[model samples]
Structures are given as structure tokens and as C-alpha cells.
Target chain A: MRSQSRIAFYLLLTPLVLWLGLLIVIPHIDMLLISLRERISFGVYDRSLLQYEKALTEPLYLRTFARTAVMSILATAITLIIAFPVAYYIAKMAKGRLQQVLFLLCLIPFYVSELVRTFGWMILLRETGIVSNLLQWTGLADQPVELLYTDATMMVGLVYTSMLFMVVPLVTTLESLDDSVIEAGYDLGGNGFSVLREIIIPHAMPGIVSGCIVVFMLSLGNYLTPTMLGGKDSLWFTEMIYNQFIVRSNWELGAAFGFMLLVLSSVIVWGMLALTGRTLKETMG
Target chain B: MIPTIPTSRAFRLTYGAYVALFFLYLALPLTVVAVFAFNDSQFPSLPWDGFTWAWFFGTERPQIGVFHERGILRAVGTSAFVAGCVAVLSVAVGTTNAFLFNRYEFRGKGLLYVLMLLPLVIPGIVLGISILIFSSTLANGIWDLAQMDIQALRPGLLLVILGQFSFITTIATLVISARLQKFDRTLEEAALNLGADRLTAVRTITLPFLAPAMVGAVVVAFLMSFENFNTTLMLVGSDAPLTIAMFDRLKEGSTPLLNAVSLLLMLGSSLLALLVILFQRRP
Candidate 1:
């Protein structure tokens, strides 16, 4: 019976091992190798960091990388600011059926595909869009303001798209907090700000960290929303990587950029983890 | 029950308005998309010419609606096929892995657990690239090994499935394993003592218990694979899914037909999500 159980265990484990080892781990290794070696001919290459140097040295690539990072950070910060109140109201104020309904209302929009969601934005912000029409109708402007390709719309799209991710985590963490703790602080003459600083924020740190990590990674790696919404001048890093791989057939350069993205996620995730003092497992959940 | 924090009437009123505006922001874009699908105008934007079903059912060559458009119908078919393959492959592997990880103890288990979750952390684009590189190299190695022109194993639908499966399977495993961790183990032990074998015990006892999670995993896997863009963009060779097709249309320029398609996708997914929520809360 023990031998049989052991055999069953091994059988169950083999598929996962093979799936991860062969597909994920080995591919990442291959990507690393491809990134390191510079292609000399159709089938020949040498080990060098020329791709990395080029990514750094090229003004276009460097600007794209910096722009992507800055926009992603701004998106993350803006999402947090916008999401906190709604999350707080749901987790703290709203009760029973109202909370459930509101939470579902927040989540239903997310059910639409990301691409579809972006398409919805495009419909509204195009030259003949309602916003532009409204401006013309109000006599605030005589012509349609082309809002589709601007940074404001880009920020709006990023924040809007990621609101659910931020809110869900914050709600989960905040819901678990004991309200009496806050009441006690209020009763003891502590003002709203102090109570928030001393108790609520401290307790909700893990959720904040997790939500920030997700929003940051999402906005950073986002290709569709930025490219589609930000239009021609978006200079989104992901688009550059996509261009390298598909358009230019520069796999080595693309692989390097992909690795740099990996590095960025790791760094931001690590930084958040460090600041919050949460372990990888805890923060991820 | 916990009492909420105290606030003044002014604060409450402001918060209420803020919440209402938030909901509008969330719901407005999709509302425009849905409404504009039937708009008689040439464009998807405002100043609706009149209401018409042409966007939904156009039968002409260039002004084709979503349904009549052969490329769209074909892409939908392709998306469905890829999603189906991914759902099945991922769920099978995921269910087995979940049970093993949750039930047993072994060497390197901690490391394996982290490694299993590594795919979720990595972006889809990176995974797509990795798989593309790895598979092409693998095809060439096989060619070198056996003087056979077996290099037809490059990018295509199969690569799409495999690339999607890499992460989707991990997600399914996480879902099922979280459920497994909470299940009572003594039921299986009692069944074993009653002379039932492990396989039979698991089939009758554990499988039923895990049915809900398995369903959720399958639905999520299918939907994710269907909607996937970045990875699909990288790995897809000649064939384009609905997302790729829609994106291509977007790049070229959009028509009300695109809005028609978005509205359909929105309705279909919202209905699916509603069903999941209803069933989840059906106790």
C-alpha cells in the first residue's frame, strides 16, 4: 500500500515537473542564451553583450524604457489614489446587500476582455467622440479636440483599467481589520488622520503592497492599452520590444528588452516587499 | 458585526456622490460601445445617424458586420479551438498537480512550489518569447539529430496552446490546490480503512468536493486563453484569433462593425460572469 501510494505520488508530480521544467524553465534559459549571443550569420552567433549596450546606447530605446517606467509608476500611484476611497467605502461603510452589489458592480466591467475594454475607451475619445462633441456643443471649443493620443488619456486608461486590481486587494485586507481598533483611537481623542496613520494604514500595508505590485507590473508590461490609446507617440517599451521581435526580426535585442522588463518587475516587486517587510509568498497572496 | 467609522452628513453626501461618479466612470465606456453598435452612423463615435442593425448583420463585401465577416467568424473559430485545447490540457495537468502538492510531502517541495508559481510572476510577453525561441531551437535540434526535415514544428496554433498552457495550468493548479488545502483529509483515511483503494476513494470523495473549483478553473482558463493578446501576438504565426483580428482592424481604422463586435464580446462575458456569481452564491 505504501509503495502504491508512492508510485501514485510520483505519477501525479511528473506532469507538473515536466510542464514547468521543459516549457517555462528551459525556455527562459534559451532566452537568456539568445539575449547574450549576438548573431553573426544566418545560423551563427558570438557571446557578447552588444544587444544590451545597444538598448542602453540608442536614444530611442533609452527614452522608451524611461518613458515606460515613469508612466507605469504614475499609473500605479494614480490607481492607488483613486481606488482607496471606493475600497474603503465598500470594506468599511457599505453593509450587507449594498456591499455585495457594489463589489460586483466594480468587478463586472473587468469581465470584459482587456482588449475590449480598451476598445470602449477608443470609441469615447476619438475625434467624433462624445467628449469632443460635448466640447463643441458647450461652445468651449469650435473643433473636436483630438484626445485619443494624449498622455492624459493614456493615464486615464491605465488607471481605469487597473482600478479593479487595486480595489480587490485593498478590500480584502481592510475587511479583516477590527473596526473597534479605529473606534478606540477615536474615543481616546485621536483624530481621523492619526487613526488612519497609526492603525489602518499599518494594518493594510500588505494589501497596499500587493495591489501596487500588480498595478505596477500590469501597467509596465502593458502593450495594448498604451499603444492603442497613446497612439503614435506612446513610445511604450513593450511596443518597442514587439517591434524588435516581429517587425525587425531582432530576437537578440527583443530578448534583452524582455529581460530588462523582467528585471524591472523584480526590482519594483522587491522594493515594495522590502518597504512593507512582507515575504514573497505573503505579498503575492 | 463591526460598526463603521463615524462621519458627518457633509462627508457622507460627498462620499455618496463620489461613489456614483466612480460607477459611471466604470460603466460609461462600455455603455457607449454597446449603444454605438446599433448606431446608423459610419463611425463608432457620437452623433448617431439613426438606429440600424447593419453593424450587427451587414452582408456586403467591405461593410460586413461581425457575423457576416468571414475573417471574424474564422478568428472566433480559431480562438474557440485554441481556448478549448488549452482548457483541457491545463485542467488535467493542474488537477493532478494540485492533489499531489496538497497531499504529499517530498524533497525539494518548497523549491518546486515556488518554481510552479514562477510563470504567474513572469509577464505573458516574456513567456511567449521564451517559448518561441525554445521551440524553434528544439525543432532545429530534432532536425540535426535525425536527418529528417521535421522543422515544421515551429510557430503556429500548437505553439499558442503550449505557451498559454504554461501559465494557465499554473493558475488552475493554484485554484485547485487552495481548495484542497482546506478539505478534510480524514474522509479519505476512513475510506481507506473501510477497504476502498486510494483511486476509488479520491474519485468518489475528493473529486466531488473539488467539482466547483475545477469548474471555476476551467472557465477562467478558457476565458483567459480566449482573450489573451500579448502572448498570442508573439507566438501566433499565420493564424489570427479574434483579438489579433480586432487589433489589426483597429490599426487599419475602425468602423461601427468593430463596435458591434466589442458589444457582443461584452454581453457574452458579462453573462458568463453573472452565471458564475449566481452559481457561486446559490447556497
Candidate 2:
């Protein structure tokens, strides 16, 4: 009977081990090797840190990587600022039906593709788009502003795209907070601000940290939003990687860039976990 | 436990206004997409150029409607087929994984579990690149001996499905394992004691309990696979998915027809989500 159970366990385990091992682990290992090697001739290669060296030394690659990191951090921060009030309202303040509806409002947009959502922003922020048209009608400017292909536009797109991720985690954490805890703070002559600082922020810290991590990773890795919103001048790192792989066919450089992204995101996530004192299991969801 | 926060009238009013604005921020862009689907304008952009169904259906220019566009339709079909395969394959493997990891204790189990989740944290673009590089290279060595077609193992729908499956299966496992953690072990034990063998115990007890989570996994996995663009872009070669096709068109310049497609995608996904919610709620 024990042997039968053991056989069943190994049998069930086969699919997972095969899938993850072949598809995920092996590929990543191959990528690491590819990232390490330099192509010498048509099919020949030499082992070197040249790929990493080139990526690090090259001004365009390094600059875009930095830019992507900064932009993602800024986007994460802004998303948190925008998401907090709404999450607070839904999780803590709103009544049953209203809360569900408000929550649904946040969720329904996620039903649409990120491509579609970003496309909608293009329609709104383009030179002849909705905002420009409104400005023209109101006589705000003689010429329509070039809202697309601007850094501010990238910021707006990033924040907009990442809002739901931040909000959901915030809502989840905030929903678990006991109302009496906040009321206790309030009853002890604590004003709203004091209660917020004393009770609410502490309770929501794990959510905030986790949400920030998720948003940061997404915004950093995001290719389409920046490319669409910021156009040619987007200067996102993923675009650099894309150019390397497809246009340039420089897989080595692209692999290095991809590895760099993996490292950067992992390091940041680790830092966040350390700072917040939350386990990976606790924070990942 | 969630409701009844202590708040002043001033805070209440302010919070209410902020919430309204926040909802607007979330809903307005989506609303714009839907509204432009009906716009009579040649361009997808705005000033609400009178209402028309030309983008949805019109004889004057058939290609102006997304459904009329051949490339877009082909992509839609490809996306559906790939997503269907991915959903089925991922759920089967993912559910089995959930049970294995949840019910067992073994050497390197913790390490293996962490490794399983690596795909979730990895960027889709990277996943695609890695898988593309890995598979083609692996196939290069094996093809001569195995006498298999290289294109089949190359970057395309098969690679796209594999790339998506890596991360998606992790999600399914997480969702299922969460459900599994809440399950009582005694139910399976109860079946076994009543003369059912191990397989029968599982089929009658464990599998039935996991059905709801498996259903949710199907929808979520299907949507993720369908909506995926990053991994698909890296791995896709000749054949295009809807997101990739639409993005290519948008880059060249698009019409309200793209908006129509966006609206259609929204409607389809919303219906799926609604079905999942209702199905889950049913006793």
C-alpha cells in the first residue's frame, strides 16, 4: 500500500518535474551559458564576460537600464499613492454593495488586454487625440501638445497600467485589518492622521511592500506601454533588448540584458523582503 | 471586520470625491476604447466624430471592421487554439503538481517548489528569449539523430505555448494548493477505508474537491495565455496572436477597427469572468 502511494506520488510528480525542468530550468541555464559566451565565427564561440562588459560599458544600454529602473520606481510610488485612497475606501469605508461595485470597477479593466489598455491611452494622449481635442475646443493652446513620446506620458502610462496590481494587494491587506483597531486609536484621542500613521500604515505595510515589488517588477519589465506611449524616444531597456534580439540578431547581448533584468528584479525583491520582514511566501501573493 | 472605519465628515467627503476620481481614472480609458468602436471617424482618435457601426460592420470598406480583416481573424483563431491547448495542458500538469507538493514530503522538495515559482517572477520577455534559445539549440543537436523537423521545435506557437505554460502552471498550482491546504485529509482516508483503492479514493474524493479551483485555473490560464504579448512576441515567428497582430497594425497606423477588436476582447473576457464567478457561486 505504501509502495503504491509512493508510485502514485512519483507518477504525478513526473509532469511537474518534466515541465519545469525542461521548459524553465534548462532554458534559464542555457541562457546563462549563452550570456557568458561571445560569438567568434558563424557557429563558433569563445567564453568571455564580453557580453556583460559590453552591456555595462555601452552608454545606451547602461543608460536605458538606469532609466527603466528609475521610471519603474517612480511608477510604483505613484501607483501606490493613487491606489491607496481607493483601496482604503473600498476595504475600510464603503458598505457591502457599494464596496463590491467599487472593487468590480477596478477589476473590470483587467479583463481587457494590456495592449488594449495601452492603446486606449494612445487614443487619449496622442497629438490629435481626445485630450488634445478637448484642449483645442477650450482654446487652451493654439497647437496641440505632443503628449505621446514624452517622459511624462510614459509616467502616466506606467502608473495607469500598474494601478490595479497595487490596488488589489492593498485592498487584500486592508480588508484583513480589524476595524476596531483603527477605532481604538481614534477613541484614544487620535485624529485621522494619527490613526492612519499608528494603525493603518503598519497593518498595510506587507501589502504595500508586496504591491510595490509587484508593480516595480511589472513596470520595469513592461515593454509595450513605454514603447507605445513614449514612442521612439521611450528609451526603455526592454526595447534595447528587443532591438538586440530581433533587429540586430545579437542574442548574446540580449541574453545578458535579460539576465541583468532578472538579477535586478530579484535583488530588489529580496531587498524589499528584507526591509519589510515578510517571507517570500507571505509577500508573493 | 472590514467596514466601519472611524472618520470625520470632512474625511468622508474627501475620501468619497477621491474614490470617484480614482474610478474615473480606471474606467475612462476603457470607456474611450468602447466608445471609439462606434466612432464614424477614419482614425481611432477622438472628438467623437459622430456615431457609426462602420468599424463593427460596413460594406463601403470591409477591412475597416476588425471582423472583416483577414489577418486579425487569423490571429484570433490562432490565439484561441493555442490558448485552449495551453489551458488544458497547464491545468493537468499544474493540478497534479499541486497535489504532489501539498501532500508529500521529500528531499529537495522545498528547493523544487521554489524552482517551480521562478517563472512567475521572471519577465515574460526573458522567459521567451530563454526558451527560444534553449529549444532551438536543443533541437539542433537532437534533430539529425531524432529525424524531427526543426521548425516544429523552433520559435512559434509551440514555443509560445511552452513559454506561457511555464508561468501559468505556477499560478494554477498556487491557486490549487491554496484550496488543497484547506481540504481535510480525512475525506480521502474515508474513501480508502470504505474499500476504495488509492486511485478511486482520489477520483471520487480529491478530484471532486479540486474541481472549482481547476475551473478558475482554466479561465485564468486561458486569459493569460490569450492576452500574452511579451513572451509571444519573443517566441512568435511566422504566425501572430491577436495582441501581436493588433500591435503591429497599431504601429503602422490603425483605424477604429482595432478599437472594435479591443471592445470585442473586453466583452469576451468579461463574459468568461462572469461565467467563472457564477459557476463558482453555484452549489
Candidate 3:
């Protein structure tokens, strides 16, 4: 029996080992190596730190990185604000079929491609789009307003895209809480707001932390939303990395940028783990 | 039950209104896309010229009406194939891992579990670009050793599948693992005690229990792979997937056909989900 268990364990470990080695470890090693290398003309990578040095000193790349950080922070804040109430409602208020349906509604967006969703935003926010046209007719604006191609529009897209991620884990954690605990708090003379503040929020801390980590990471790494919505002038960090690699053919600089973003994400994940006193396995799995 | 204050009718109405407004916000984009699918205008937006099926069925030559575009159809086919392959492969690997992890205790177990999950937290752009670079480098080395003529290893179907599978498999494993945790270990123990071998006990007792979760994981995995854009954008070869194709067209400008495609995709996925739910609820 012990031998059989050992065999089973080894079998389970094999796929994970193979996946990590091939996908994560190897790719990262290659990226690191390339980051140390030089780039030839026409986007071909040659063997030097010239690109990294240049990227580090360049004001454009620095500015873009700072802008991405600010945008990601703001988007994360907005997503949390919108998602918390809905998650609270679903977790504490809704039950049975209604809960299932509401949860499914949150997930349905996952089925649609991001491209399509963003396009929908484009149609809604364009000069002759619904929002703009409505604003014009209502005399909110003299003419159709230009709402597209701005940071605000980009934030709208990011928050909308990532809200589900925040809501799901929050719901799951909140659902696991004992309703009687809240009832007890009320029985002991706590008001609704006080119960929520002292009991519910603390209990759901892990979920909130996990949700924030996810939203932040996704927002930081997101390139497409910022590019499509913010238009040509948008200098998102991911876009900068993309330009370095694809447009300028500077792999080392791109690698440096990629590494920076990676380290930042890892730090955030680590901070969340420390704060919540739980491992990634616990939160994610 | 503790006595609670009854919510007023006005409060209930306000809450209902809020919920309705939220749903409207969520559904508005989808509704617009679906409605514009029937629009006669070339553009997807308002001021409907007339109602027509010309976009759906018109074949004017290279371009086709709007719906008959060969590129869109080909991209859709490619996406389906790739997503299908990813789903099957991920489910197979994920289920096996789940069984192994759940059924037995062994050395390096925690480390292996962490390794499985690393892909989930990693950024998609980094994953995509790294995979592209690694694959090309490896392909170059293999070609040199074998002396085979293979040019440009970066963009292709294989890379896209690899890129997608890396993350999708994590999702599958996580889902299956959750299901496995709730499974009764006593059933397997009884089977083993009753003169059944490990494989047979697993085949009869465990596999049947895990089948639904495995199926659900496959569906979710397939959908994720199908809708994938960031990684696909980075790793896809010259040939575009449906998402990338739509993105390209949108970049040029909005067209009603893109909305048509979105509506079709939305309807198709919802129908599939409905079927799966019905099937699951049948027994």
C-alpha cells in the first residue's frame, strides 16, 4: 500500500514538473539571457547591456512605466469599489437560483472575447456613439463629446474587464462565512454598518487581498485595453516593452522592462501572502 | 431566526432598480452587438439604413458581403481546432494530476503543487514572449543538429497551443483538484480492501465521480483558449485567430459584421452552457 501511494505521488508530480520546467523555468531563463544581450538592426537580438542601459536612462520609458503604475493603481481602486457591493450582495443577500444566475451573469463576460467587449465600449463612447449622442441630446454637451482615447476610457475598460475576477473570490470567501456570526454581532447590539466593518470585512480580508492582487497584476500586464482605447499616444509599460521588442527590435531593453514588471508583480503577490498569512496555494486553489 | 427589521417597499424597489441597472450595463454591449448584426449599415453604430441579410450572406468576390469573408471563417475554424486540442490535452493532464495529488501522499508534493500554479500568476505577455523566444531558440538548435530546413519558428499554431495550454491547464487542474477534495476516500479504500487492485478501484470508484468535473473543466478550458487574445496576439503566426482577426478589422474601423460575429459567438457559448447545465441537472 505504501509503495502504491509512492507510485501515485510520483505520477502526479510528473506533469507538474514537466509543465514548469518546459514553460516557466526555461522561458524565464531564455528571457534573462536575452535581456543581457544586445540587439542587431531590424529587431534581431545580438549578444549586450546597451539596450538595457539606454532604456533605463530614456525619459520616455521611465515616464511610461510611471504612468502604467498610476493607471493600474487607479483601475484596481475602481474595480474594488464597484465589485465589493455586488459581491457583498451576492454573498450575504442572494440565495439559491438567484445567486446562481447572478454569478453566471458575472461569468458570462468571460465567454466574450476582450476584443469584442472593448469594441462595444468603442461604439458606446465614440463621437456619434450612444453615450456621446445621449449627452448631446440632453444638453449635457453642446456637441458629441470626445470621451474615447483617454486614460479615463482606458480605466473604464480595465475595471469592467477585471471586475469579475475581484467579485468571484470575494463571493466565495464571503459565502463560507457563518451568517450566525453576523446575527450574533447584531444580537450583541452592533449596527449593520458596524457588523460589516468589524466582522464581515475582517473575515473576508483574504478574499479582498486576493482579488486586489489579481486585479492589480492583470491591470499592470494589460497591453491591449490601453492600446485600443487610449489610442496611438498611449504609452503603457507593456506597450513600451512591445515596441522595444517588435517595433524597435531591442530585446535587451524589452527584457529589462519585462523583468521589472515581473518583479513588481511578484512583490505584490508576496505582500498579499504576508498580509493574509496564507500561501498562494490556499488563496488560488 | 432572529427578528430583523423588514425592508420597506421603497427600499426593495430601489434595490431592484439598482440590480436592473447593473444588468443593463452588463448586457448593453451584448445587446448592441446582437441588434446591429441585422443592421443594413456598413458600420456597427446607429442610424440604421435598413434591415438586410446581405452582410451575412453576400458574396461579392474577395471581400464577400460582410459575413462571407473567408478570413473570418478560416480564423474561426482555426480557433475551434486549437481550442479543442487544448481542452482535451489539458483535461487529460489535469485530471490525472488531480487523481494523483488527491489519492496519495508523497515527497515534494507541495513543491509540485506550487509549480503547477506558477503559470496562473505570471503575466500573459511575459509568458507569450518567453515561450516564443524559447521555442524559436530550441527549434533553431534542432534544425542545426538535424540539418533540416525550417525557417522562422516564432509564430505558428503549435506555439499558440503551447502558450494557451500553459495557463489553461492550471485552471483545469485547480477546478479538478477542488472537486477531488470533496470526493470520498472511503469508497476507494473499500474497493481496495475488497480484492480490487489500485487501478481497478480508481477506474470504477474515482473516475466515475470525477467525470463531471473533468467535463466542466474541459468546457471552461476550451472557452478560455477560444477567447484568449493577449497571448494569442503575441504567439499567433501570420494566420489570425477569431479574436485577433476581429481586432485587426476593428483597428481598420468598425464594421457591422464584427458585431454579427460577436452575436453569433455569444449565442453559441450561451447555448453550449445551457446544454451543459441541462445535461448536468438531468440526473
What is candidate 2's local distance difference test score?
0.87
**Which consecutive 10 residues in model 1 chain A have the weakest lDDT in total?**
A276-285
Question: Which candidate would rank higher by DockQ, 1 or 2?
Answer: 2
lDDT of 2 by residue, A137-244 (tens): 899978887688888988888898878889999999999988788778877988777888888999999889989988998898898988898867668888888898
Question: After TM-score superposition, what is the CA distance of residue B62 in candidate 1 from its true location, in Å?
Answer: 5.4
Top DockQ model: 2
Across residues B1-283, which tens digit of lDDT does each residue of candidate 3 receive? 1124355678667766776776777777677777877787767776777887766787764224545788889999999999999999899889877876776666777887887888888889888888877887788788879976564566888889989999899899888888899998899999989999988998999888888888888888888899898788778888788888888888899777888788888877887777667766756
Residue pairs that clash (backbone atoms under 3 angstroms), model 3: A37-A48, A38-A48, A43-A249, B58-B65
Kindly report which residue stretches of model 2 are placed more than 4 angstroms away from their true locations once superposed: B1-8, B143-149
Q: Which TM-score value belongs to model 2?
A: 0.97
| Predicted complex 3: CAPRI docking category | medium
What does DockQ come to for candidate 3?
0.55
For each candidate, the DockQ is: 0.65, 0.67, 0.55
Off by over 4 Å in 1: B1-5, B61-63
Chain A structural similarity (TM-score) per candidate? 0.97, 0.97, 0.90
Residue A3 Cα positional deviation in candidate 3, in Å, after optimal superposition:
6.0
Candidate 2 C-alpha lDDT tens digits along B28-52: 8898989989988778776667988
